[model samples]
Target: MPIRAGEWLAHGSQPEWTMTVVEKTQGAPRDAGPLAELDDHGLVAACLAGRRDAFDLLVDRHKRSVYLLCYRFVGTHEDASDLSQDVFLRAYRGLRRFRGDSSFATWLYRIGVNVCLNRVSMRQPLQRSLDEMPNLAAPQADPAVALVRREEARRVRAAVARLPRKQRTALILRVYHDLPHKEIASALGTSVGAVKANFFHALANLKKLLAADTRSGS
Candidate 1:
């Protein structure tokens, strides 16, 4: 059962969505060093030395954040899972090129942003069906109140998805990921000033979109 490059790993309910296994390295330890004991740099170095398990560890550590970031852009668990897997595959293939100019997380975020932007650009703007919308209800909350909140949140997500690519990326990195302006700029490959501008404009556009939705409902 050796996984080969370009093979798919089925994830979740999306049987059509597959994560590619970019390369299989020899001499990778079956039971390698405890990944929790190593820093990113250490794991990366181990991976370079043909320890495949190190990369698995790296994936385990960052996959949640990466998946959440993907979900913010695509607005579906299936698409986000697909994109997140793609991000990791790209990261694995590009590991040797990493020069440590930034933290590994920042570098990974940059890759994820690029992958998402490319995918987003090739398709029509994302629109979530009611079934695709997230359930944002709290236990014991009134059903009516929860429904209203969920609808509002969905509107906001839709508004964000409709933003210009750069603005959307900047806003997601800053607001959702809680990344600072400098880190966001690093992730987006832009200047700090530019990141701030994009965030400002994204918020302004979201306000307009949401307000229009509210006014129409009144």
Candidate 2:
């Protein structure tokens, strides 16, 4: 999923909440100037100083990753898009609270994880899997092989989703995002030891879940 700048949240089907928040904080458009060269922290400073375009650049840099994280949790484009937008909206409102203790991306990930967990808690478990099987299968691949692989992938995803919250989050960050334990600890607001423990337990539990599924022929 290639996320174009200003396109995902601008879709007509997006929730009304994002529109209100954007209208309130969005500054007038201007030329990129030198702001494009800035790092995340520099961009944050620029945004706080009223350079709204700086925030736009930050969005362009991180939105795809954020959307993917949300998609992994929710298993659908619509819900992921909504949750992604909500995460950014919260980040924008809480910009002042971003104390440079972690990298901007890590801070954003924390916000994204919290938003995803809250959304997941309020809804029933997702039965649909991510729309990524097409990418996994080659154009000329056997249909039966592709079907089997897709089903396996779906079951794996469902199993991951069912893990306890900390375990699930730790696994996703470490495996999918490739974040180191130290960085994951920062995003999760825990120590590295705790993150490692959760990750180990997550892998153990996931293996058991998959083995059970295989036994049941599900």
Candidate 3:
């Protein structure tokens, strides 16, 4: 019962659309009571036991955060949506290898970070700013204020993008995703101290970039 391309509506509340898509794709039962009550570990066990809908439950639970993380990395709705789907697909394929060394969320985040980095590496230089991307404003906000906000967001994103790869990843995970240092270290496959150092340098570099942008009257 996956939603067909023609059946998908572009206009609607985001959460509503996301749930509709998840329900359709997973074909989850209407009585998802027990499945929904199980924790991540339980759901993972169910998925391994051939309960494909259990995996869909995971998707429904985590999709919003995953989408937001992808959006932060790519700064566009379309790319983020595609990347989020890719993350879940990759997670599904790799489920057998999941050893429970970290939380499921952390493990999934590691996959997402790797996928985004690979995508970024393969793309042209990030010449597009956040303002030029999408979804930085409310529907009825003042146009002038929204423009200013977009410009500021664009400047910050540009600065973050210019950091060394590790630093950039650390900053995005820490600030944008609000992951703890230990969780971030697990995701990046680095030590906690290293993650801290990367975040420190990222902040320093961001300050300098923002200052420069301000001075240049951008």
Candidate 4:
């Protein structure tokens, strides 16, 4: 996908397939043709130009990852879906502030992190459990082994949630989302050094938390 500049939407949906375009004689959509080929910035431009379909494309592209991030925060599919929509809505409303300082995905993730953090703080002690880890077994694999792995993943997630805010954010963005320290720093509004320090402590603390859990037979 190529990122190009447009007068409007200089920055930033769903899957490419879900965007249905219709040809109109007047007010024909810009970048309507081959929208999937345009990069995120280009789509943002189109969206600014009043092409709703372009925003839909952006949502399709990012919805899965955004939902996953929200799920990790709230730990429920329903809440995650609602937060994902809220994230996109906020992004759409705040598009003018994007500034193109970071990649579109990074900017969107920053918004998501803020939204999730606010939600978590409002409802201290997030009630849901993180049991949505991917299935690691073949169809014929042993159920007991899968259950054990799921339990371990759940414990690890619980430990992560217990981490200090900065450490948890650093670890989640770095480990789960595969974000670089620089990007995580940008998202966290902190320095790369701080991000690294937090991530390191997050790992060490996570190990201690899990070990304690084991010793306690939990």
Candidate 5:
């Protein structure tokens, strides 16, 4: 669980069974995450000028959050890493086109949602397999309580994944990313009103499904 350098990844049948081993406890201070030495515009400029190291800084700051979002959307670690990589690659390609009208973080997440949507569309919305969720919560003293909590989180995530792609993107952007509705609208190339509409419907549908689940104990 240590965030050390040169970790080895070992995966079992389920992602929860996978683990990492760190070779070193610490690294250089320069590798520390981007603490806003450059604004979004400056970073983008450096990236466009072929300073690849600048892009690495951006990724270090946002990759953890972005990968977690992808894992929630796709329900698998194998695919989430791929999706996260794809998101960064797409952002790299599109950096030249980014008008700087929006913050670069917002631009990156906009692309992240689109990548997740494309991934979901390739599979049937209702065909989620629930045996592979990764447990990121703190471990509970009682194993039964931990199992129940993990199962409940997986069920909720599956329901969210099944939503229409736009609605899912809207809800995750606004909720997980803690993005404002107005910013989400700009990211998705829509209006604030449309973002609200998606969030409203997405929340309503998820609530209904989760309520039914509680009643049935599924």
Candidate 6:
């Protein structure tokens, strides 16, 4: 599909989520002024002009987000890596077709979510288990810190993975990807209200799941 630019809309009550930016081409209206200063559209433009190096800047910028998206959606480093490659490769090949009508990351995540959905649809029932997918991205911490952080991340991913498809997508897109509701709608191919509804259910379930995990541990 041809890309449109900057249509990443947010809900009226979006949470304050800061995103890292990346570098972009000079003299563009949105130059990547600071390292990680590049916006979605700028990266798209540079990559489309045969500047593969520009794509690296975008990769470095969103790699963690994309990797986390994969981990949350699939719960395994194996599948996430597979899907991450699919996401970026699809982007690279499809860049020329983009019309710059949406934020590049939004469009990219639309790709990510769809990729996950397709993977889920193709899985066998027994293969759909969630408890095995752990968040392997925990930062280096003291033994106690690592234990606490890893424990929390594991609990969160398990809860998120158990959510129904819509809820999981909404929760991950909003909480993990830091996208607003409307952009999430665009990515999920749904409405803003639906996105909110899904996010609510997903978060509620995650909280419940976390509470249960805590109670069990205690």
TM-score for each predicted model, relative to the true structure? 0.81, 0.80, 0.81, 0.79, 0.79, 0.66
Ten contiguous residues with the weakest lDDT in model 2: 19-28
> Can you write out model 4's per-residue Cα lDDT over 55-143, one digit (the tens) per residue?
88888789888998887777666788899999999999988787788888899989999998898778754444435544454632777
Output the better candidate (2/6) by TM-score.
2
Q: Per-model C-alpha lDDT, please?
A: 0.84, 0.85, 0.83, 0.81, 0.79, 0.74
Clashes of each: 0, 0, 0, 10, 0, 16
Question: In candidate 5, which residue ranges exceed 4 Å CA deviation?
Answer: 1-36, 125-132, 215-218
* 133-189 per-residue lDDT for model 6 (tens digits): 443455565767766766676677777777898998998888877899999998777
On a 0 to 1 TM-score scale, where does candidate 5 land against the true structure?
0.79
Over the stretch 1-218, how does candidate 5's per-residue lDDT look in tens digits? Answer: 45523234445233344345655633222543463487668878987988777777778777887898887688778888999999999999988999999888888888888888888889743334445545555768998887778777777887887788778888988888889999999889999999999999999999988887778884
Please, what are the lDDT tens digits per residue for candidate 2 over residues 68-172? 899878777788999999999999999989988899999999999999999999995557544543365254268677777778778888889889999999998
Q: List the residue pairs that clash in candidate 2.
A: none
By lDDT rank, best first, the candidates go 2, 1, 3, 4, 5, 6
Q: Which pairs in model 5 have colliding backbones?
A: none
lDDT of 5 at 36: 41
lDDT of 3 at 169: 90
Each candidate: RMSD: 10.7, 10.3, 8.1, 12.1, 8.7, 15.1
Query: Which pairs of residues collide in candidate 1?
Result: none
